[model samples]
Target: MGPSITDVPKSVLQDVIIKLPTKSIIMCKSVCKTWYSLISDPAFAKLHFAQAEAYPMVRPVDRRSVSRNLYLVEPEDSSGFDLKDHDCNRSRVHMNLSKYKLPVCHPEELLNYHRNGIVMPSHETERKVSMKITQIDDNNNEVDLGDGFAFMMQYDHNSYNLVNSCNGLLCLSYFFGNRPAAVCNPITGEFINLPHGPKHEKAMTLIGSGLGFSPRTNEYKVMRILKEQTPDTNKVAEIHTLGTGSWKSVGTARCSDSELSFPTCVKGMLYWFCDKWSGCSVISFDLDTEEFQSVPSLPFEDGYDVSMGDLGGSLCLCKVESFEINVWVMNDSGPQKLWMKKISIHTGFSRSWPRGVYIPMKYFENDGLLMFNSRLNAFFYHHPGNHSPFIYLKLREIKYSSSEAISHVPSFISLKDILVGKDVEILNINSRCAVLKLPGETEALSLVEENASF
Candidate 1:
């Protein structure tokens, strides 16, 4: 028998809600009037929300493959976790490209040939191209899941310019001369254009732009910061929220003389290292409340400043001095704890932290890898490994530094190529791809054999 409401302890009731998933807790309110009242209370809701925040979701690391060559050479056991006495040594794997009918290219040569930081356009065109996302098996061959399925925005031949990709969506800023800037999801091809605000003569002076999703209200927001030229010498800031279709002034923009960097969204908040007109401060924007708050100033000695980076799903402040690099993870509220750990003090290009490099705007590859361009070197940081020591995978080398004009390159590969091995009794292709499985089928051999011909 259930205990009476008067006999049940409030602490026990709070524990029950806290242990349940956020979705389940909301559904519990429908069970009874007392349960509804308890769950509907703002204070109780806030408490549960806080608990959820405390336990941020951690994705399981796929122990399948690590590198391209490794995946091909030994498709199975590619995780490298089973390799005993595997120290932090930079080791290269050898593979015969010709074995898998792959192009005969040296690992280093292939790495140098490709242009690194280019955002693959979401739009489709005559020549379709696809990039490898995850190595499903260790065969060293890619399971090219059609270009659009993995991309965040619709593939547009024209109109789409990738600024940067963060989390799952890409931060795209369109330049139609006098047209307003538009942010979009490359995978789903959904986009929201920012509204034109007070016209400024010098829009070129703008330094940073960013987009973030608020799960609480299911809304996406974009923020832009521009350095204004005037006798007053004060920075200006503007923000735009999708569906509203108008730019709203936030506050006096404050940023350093150095190129302004975009805000980093961490733990449901947008944080920016800014030099406010009054003084330099780390400003944080709360997505839930849409309010701005200031963080404690960074402690630096001898005028040395620290740059911010994302560390293990948290906002990190990085300090580099000669050969030593220190990464500090922010723990604003906890057991009065702030974790300051040293990632490496090694000497070489390998020691350079790629996550700290600022890209205009970028999206997080489906697997949480960051793709960006710095000078001639295209850089990628795959987050499958330890977050601090970001694996700096080179994408491509830039041949020319011409005008930064936007161009679209579509994937030539068909959607049919991606669904090769997966079991599909009923395959439906329309605007989006869907697969239906048949009962009593242990495996789908015919589909795998047909795709193998490709």
Candidate 2:
């Protein structure tokens, strides 16, 4: 045999390990103590997270489902595309949320419980909601979570209506700020519940919310735009850091009263569309300095439904006309000329087409496919020159009404590592469906191979 891996130099070994994906890195930990020490380093986690590719996390658009499951969208050949059936082309890796029960706490109920100050769930009862997660392949066959892989969560939210994914953590909350938000790593099953913000004196309308990470400070922040129903109809912003447990006023939000759209976080900036007297312009907020700036305005005409998304790390604007959809990508430049129309999909008002504004979700770089979602259905479009340019793939609607998809990158960083001294609930589920309380530093990952082949 050749030289052993242990014979390699420390510097060379690290360079190779950091380049591997998160699942493989975890497996390397059990190989030996040296590998474990290297992979477990906090610095290595950050480096690996920065290099990981993002995948789309698809879920039910309608939040009425009693049991919501997270789906990983994978692309297949055009042969699976069917005009009659919507669930033929794509395969999903289901992360079942039905097994775990979310602790229900509405905003009003939590306010009343604050008379004696809100108390966290006791440690003895924290293990009540342990759950087992299984992976289903493209052939619809059930498989184990994987070797040395497990998933668990100690949930503490009523509903996951408002979801903002950044880095490797998901910011889950109820729409209109009806409940406290929880920052959770679905892959690791570790979560921290944020304290509710101060109650506003005047009635406030939630315009939009975003979760972003600041690499400069190595901190994650949540920003909320609330429009006070006052005479001026002015908008103000509030920000909450992960471990702070309180929100501070962040001055005014510069945006007019357009229809509310979900914000997208790219790099360290959060962007959303806002109506202007001239037309509609994109507004961006920097997570590091906590400053807001206006991006170059779009050149499109008014009176069309618009949405924002991140395509290949650049800001993409999706405009939906009567039946056609145009996806424009903007290079990070100072002028407006950098914005170019990337994908133009013309789906005539056919009988099979869902009649609603389509929102551009994610763009598959290697496959040259762009995915769009609407209130009623979801469609995947391959750029010109590919077989079957326009294909519709609707999610199986057994229990849920509609579905929504967003891009998410999984990270191996533990919440306890970031929020030191804070009490984080750890839930562990093995391949046998056994529930146990693992140590804080323990890692449990479920591997799902992402395929976007033609």
Candidate 3:
């Protein structure tokens, strides 16, 4: 008789299971009692987690292949690279769900189905293109509300807007007219309009806002710091919770007009850089507790503007000087001690003073690297630093023009046709649910196989 199949060494089995796709791992849980026991080991799970974490959440090199030419910029040297050519390429490359090999269903699918296959836009739009949406569902077909959904928030042509997404909801605010705000679940096509607050005269000011979810209560909240007209008063911070339907005030003592920047939300709290004429501090607001606290000044010399972002899972403060950028990652205060690492800056542009430029750091799920840039009009897919040695996306050539008027120019790039690259891989996974890729497999090939049966 042939040898029993179960004779494989435990070490060999572990290696095989670890290399399998996540879906396959779940399937192997039912293969046999031994296999199931091996797969369910906490130590094995931790090893897999460490392996996954080793890869960069967002590979800086991968940004090179991302398509950056979405708008038509009208530069002086318009050597036949006009709007028509750009539109033609956009139409040709516009993502089609049936064309990619996605492992999981997209949240957009459920959102569209709820709306008769129409994804709702935050702003009114006449331009319509056919795009498929996919909803994420568990084994039981229930929605996964922890990972947030992504969707479009439309605004006027020349407006500044800021968006911070957390826990399946997005907080969107526009910096034109009354500075309207809204909370939207792109996956559910459900959005609640926020009450417009008092208007401000300064149109060029940066409006800081963030969205966060409270797991304890399952409630969502939005926070904004607007420049108050009465700069001398201490009423600059404002907050709005999803269920409350209106803006509320957070009373922090006012600092000098030039010292306040938009707040960055981390760990259920909103933080902002505060340089009161007396000293520099980081002001934080705990949304759940409704309490305010302040952290000591960042480790840096004077005269540098500090910005906050998420690095790995911790909060990081970035200080940029001429041709140099210093990033400090805050660590545990006791056991490990506070560890700060410096990322040498290669971008040569003089560190411009923090203005109303809405730079929101987006943490990619693939790797742990934090991604963002200073260009407001550029889409999130493009890299903005000059040291990257990649072709610059000419904004003039790719700028969007109104179909009706020859000279009607818009302020912001219309992202109606833009596709988040993350969605492509996700949809591929949902459809197959168990396809394993070898180490050297190309993304394009994986995408091709993902869409083969769809």
- How many residue pairs clash in each candidate at the backbone level? 37, 1, 39
For model 3, the run of ten residues with the poorest summed lDDT: 445-454
Which lDDT tens digits does candidate 1 get at residues 1-454?
A: 8867646676788777655544455567787777777776656744653433111111111111111110011112223212111255432322111110101112222233233533332212233334432212111233444557434212221223334334433355432221225543222223333445666554334556666556686565676666655544555566665556456768755456444443577766777765434444466676666666656555444223355645446676555555544445677677553545524333235544333332211213233323233331332233334323333323212122211211111111122222222232221111121111111111111100011000
Query: Which candidate number would show the highest lDDT if scored against the true structure?
Result: 2
| Per-residue accuracy of model 3 over 257-323 as CA lDDT, tens digit each | 5444444555666666665555565666777876666555567655345666555556677665565
Q: What TM-score against the true fold does each predicted structure earn? A: 0.44, 0.67, 0.44
Candidate models: Cα lDDT each: 0.39, 0.59, 0.39
TM-score, candidate 3, is 0.44
Off by over 4 Å in 2: 1-44, 61-65, 74-157, 175-180, 275-279, 334-338, 348-352, 374-377, 420-454
User: lDDT for model 1, on a 0 to 1 scale?
Assistant: 0.39
- List candidate 3 stretches off by more than 4 Å: 1-160, 177-180, 196-208, 225-228, 259-262, 274-281, 301-306, 332-339, 346-370, 376-397, 400-454
Worst 10 residues of 1 by lDDT: 445-454
lDDT of 2 by residue, 377-401 (tens): 4556555544445554544433344
Ranking by TM-score: 2, 1, 3
What does the lDDT read for residue 347 in candidate 1? 25
